[model samples]
Target: MKIEILGTGCSKCKRLEERTNEAVTELGLEAEVVKVEELDQIMEYGVFKTPGLVVDGEVKESGKVPTVKAIKQLLS
Candidate 1:
């Protein structure tokens, strides 16, 4: 699975990235966690908010940082 964290390196973005990594580790899933810092690339996902989470090319969360448990659910 490809997990994309969309943001311009803000604190929330970093937190989301960390939570996503934790989620993937807890789930024991091999997913590529990429940070999409480029505005053009983030816009491609149609997410206007920072700290967006994309699972397998689909937007799963946005605007706010979700908990590790929530992220695990999203990954599931």
Candidate 2:
């Protein structure tokens, strides 16, 4: 699976990225976690907010940093 975290390197964005990595590791899934810092790439996801989570090319969350538990659920 492919997971994308879209943000401009803000605190929330970093948190989301860390949590996402933790979730993936806990699940023992081989996935690519990408941080989309480019404005154009983030806009392509149609997200007007920072800290967006995209899974399999689909936007999963936006505007807030999700907890590790929540991330695990999303990955699952």
Candidate 1: regions farther than 4 A off: none
lDDT of 2 by residue, 1-76 (tens): 9999999999999999999999999999999999999999999999999899999999999999988999999888
* Clashes by residue pair, model 2: none
Per-candidate TM-score against the hidden true structure = 0.97, 0.97
Error of 2 at 13 (Å): 0.4
Candidate 2 vs. truth: CA RMSD?
0.5
Candidate 1 per-residue lDDT, tens place, 1-76, comes to 9999999999999999999999899999998999999999999999998989998889999999999999999999
The CA lDDT of each predicted structure is 0.95, 0.95
- Candidate 1 steric clashes: 0
Report the Cα lDDT for candidate 2.
Answer: 0.95
lDDT of 2 at 6: 97
